[model samples]
Target: MSTTTTAPGTVPAAGTTPGAAQGPPKSRRSRRPGLIPTVVLLAGAGYCLLPVAWVLIASTKSSRELFSTFTFLPGTGFTRNVADLSAYRDGVYWQWMLNSLFYAGVGALLSTAVSALSGYALAKYRFRGRESIFNILLTGVLMPPVILAIPQYLLMAKAGLADSYTSVLLPSILSPYGIYLARIYAAAAVPDDVVEAARMDGAREWGIFTRIALPMMLPGLVTVFLFQFVAVWNNFLLPYIMLGDDEKFPVTLGLYTLLQQGASAPALYTLVITGALLAIVPLIALFLVIQRFWSLDLLSGAVKS
Candidate 1:
């Protein structure tokens, strides 16, 4: 048979010619979505969410029903439980709620503001001791809360601020972790050219910071605020050591107090559980509310040109 020659640069059909250079192999089509990651994620979700579900159901239960009924079973004592909580120790639970709100809300807001300002300064300004200061702050982050707590308490006592609202609120105001996050965000999100341009245009430093930098750093600030909020809200040891008065207690300490008494007075167990459920509602709601404002893209910042 006579042979026919192909074009020199002709690619073999399906690119399968022996000894030919090949592109990356085509990925195989999966018949279904990945099962292992899905299973793992679902397992993790269930593990976290199951306790929340238990609490919700348990809170609805009457004391007797709580012990007798299946854990997941619903009960009808939710209103009564709320009433008992309200009536307990002259409605002290609500005071704890308010105190928690103040500590977390005010503390987070102040911390975010300070972190934003400090982060921006560190990121944009050329100053002596910048790296040293940053390193010190970072070191603070590594230091355990336990290490600082007693010293903080002692200092508060010296200043006569201990066992007061200032004792709890003041210590939480400057968060090294928040500063670290803010510094990273500021560096990533704020461009040097923009800062220079603002300066050249005769904008004052504060003006540039408040008007130009703040908007760019807003997303990161919101993240900082949320993190600090959760931290302050969940903080137990600081408030526990600082405030001796029950009236000044945050919800965390209040819950701890209830839990302590719960060992002897088992009836307080339901109240503790109920209060815990209530405590987390604000966090969840804050998350949902903040979700609308948080932009992942902005936080990631512009890709390198």
Candidate 2:
């Protein structure tokens, strides 16, 4: 047997043809983000965070120093702002906060439940006009909530629910987007064979869903809950139109009123800023608390085909 003598480094390996051209060195290829993308991301971050920074800084400032000084400078009035906000109209700010929590909390829970049921049915059950129904929901997802506000208001007025918490809570409970998300998530996360196995074990539909499908779909439902909660928490238009009672107003609407009043008084601007800053705390805390649920691996021990 003749052996092929190979020169060090320059020789081809066993399979490669001799004198084959080599590609460029790996070190020459750049893996870092391009300058333009980096710039764009930085710009986007600044655009988003600048307002938050301003809110934080402004919230710490008193009304006198709000505009009189530099924009980003921190002031010494944070405690005073809190005190004034607490003292404003017998602590009505807290009432708005409580109202927001109610709307967002109750609305998110109900919406998530409806979405879970509707999505699971649409994804798993084959029925007549299922696609049509899903398509209609997609259309609803496309339709802006702003456009529906007037009709919702009209319906609520007709039902004598206008200016009540029920109007806001009821409208928030049926989220088309949440349903859409749930359906997609169910189709992806909940396996068909697992469902069939549950059926073969004589598990009722409701029991299978509650026991098996629900655990698998928990992350998606959490996402839907977060979305709906944030939407209702930050909602301004629907509540603005549906409610005339300032006492029932959510934090968003309450802040808007303070903003409008600030136009004349200018002192209320500090209160508005302080209120806006505080309004975001619950959402942040909620995200931090609920994020752990998303990390659960519920499908690890799922039945394998």
Candidate 3:
């Protein structure tokens, strides 16, 4: 038997060609495309967060320090700013906060309820003109709220509801987008056989909906509520047009009024910044509280054998 001696650098692997240039694996190379999305996401996040950071830092500054200091630096006037804001107009800022809470909370709840009913009906029922109705709602969704603000104000004026909380609340309660979301969610989240079984057990339509369907739809409803709450909370034009009385103004309009006044009285600028900072707290809190509900998968046990 003859023995073959291989040179030190000339040994080939089992299948690879000898003297082939070794390179990184294909998987690592594929990950290079992900960097673009990551860069885009970081840029987007920075764009969104930069204003919030400026607001937070600016709120801490006194009027004199606000312009003198660096834009991102924190100052020592947050407490004083709060005090001045509270003292303004006998604490009307708190009233605006409460009005905003009422409008957002009540309007979101009512909108979610209406969306739930409308969505469930649209998903499960085979009524005449149902698609047409949903298409109309889609059209409403496409129509900007700014466009409707004038007509809504006029309607409220004709009905003697202008300048009242009811005007804001009523218009906010019927959200076409909310209804559309609910319809899509219901069709996906709910199983048709479950409804048939409930009906076979002699359950009334309302009972079946409340007891069975509602629980399954809770996550979607929460989303609708959150969206409507944020929309109503941040609304300006509708309230600005509908309300002449500053007393009924939601925080958004109230802040705008403050901003307008700040042009004349620069001291109110600090208050406006402080109020703007405070305005976002409830929304943050609400998102924190509501996020846990979204994790629940309620449909898992609905059709167990």
Candidate 4:
């Protein structure tokens, strides 16, 4: 074989170059989502939205139109339906709405206060039996609400408080999950050094908590408050088990009783549909209104400082 000498620093041809026998560079391939994932997500959204869509359409139909027409079609009796609902039993529906508001608003406020206090202490202080206390409270989360309702009703009865609004309101003010959420929020949001600094400045424990800690925990407390509000609003079993008087009924129980009566009176069916539509309106409006201010990051125990 004849040797070929090249100029200094000159590149040789591909086949002639030593150690240049590797394969070509691989190009990146497009990654398209598999068909099943897209379909499942779409299906889940459709499933959740189905009832809401039906309720909207059903509210518009007259008693006759509701049974006569297809489920999705709109009818001409929307205004008449609302008027009829308003006229029913001298507008007892509005009373139920007010009761629901009172329960949610007052109960949520109290629950948030309790949760904030307990959570702040639990997170910031190292006390004896802290783990035990937390574990006991967490056990409440596992207990079914139905299981608690019976005993709560019995206790309220023994206290002569049953069949009263207090029977409903009192039980809702202490939520274990709310406390848990508050603890997580406190641990994540309030810095220990900040608290130490406040203490060194001769601030009382309560003063430091009220002025400094509470403002930082506000975002988390708001979440706890909203959760409690919705829980009280949507609650049916507790109120149903505790209160017998229709006058004291919350909207959930009232609407349910109305639906039960629909089996005998189809006319009430229309009222039930209309009431159901109205019952969810405030909650939807509340979510829309507060969603703008709600800091969801606090829910997961993360804050931007």
What tens digits encode model 4's per-residue C-alpha lDDT throughout 1-305? 75656678987766665445556665443334566688999999999999989989999999899988676888888899999989989998999999999999999999999999999999999989999999999999778899899899999999999999999999999999999999999999899999999999999999989999999899889889989999999999999998999988999999999999989999999889889999998898888867866645445445444
Show model 3 residue runs off by greater than 4 Å: 1-28, 296-305
**What are the lDDT scores of the predictions, listed in order?**
0.91, 0.93, 0.92, 0.91
Worst 10 residues of 2 by lDDT: 296-305
Candidate 2 local lDDT, 1-305, one digit each (tens): 75655587775667776655677566633755476689999999999999899999999998788879776879999999999999999999999999999999999999999999999999999999999999999999999988899999999999999999999999999999999999999999899999999999999999999999998898899999999999999999999999999999999999999999988888898999999999999999999878755543344434342
Residue 117 Cα positional deviation in candidate 1, in Å, after optimal superposition: 0.9
Give the per-residue lDDT digits (tens) of candidate 1, residues 1-305. Answer: 75546679976577365555557555654634587789999999999999999999999987888877576878999999988998999999999999999999999999999999999999999999999999999999999988999999999999999999999988899999999999999999899999999999999999999999998899899999999999999999999889889999999999999999989999998899889889999999999889966554545555523
Sort all candidates by TM-score, best to worst: 3, 2, 1, 4
Clashing pairs in 3: none
- Tell me the TM-score of each prediction against the true structure: 0.88, 0.89, 0.90, 0.87
Which of candidates 2 and 4 is the stronger one according to lDDT?
2
Error at 176, model 2, angstroms? 0.8
Candidate 3 at residue 281, lDDT?
100
RMSD of each: 4.3, 4.3, 4.6, 5.1
By lDDT, is 1 or 2 better? 2
Alpha-carbon lDDT of model 4: 0.91
Candidate 1: the clashing residue pairs are none
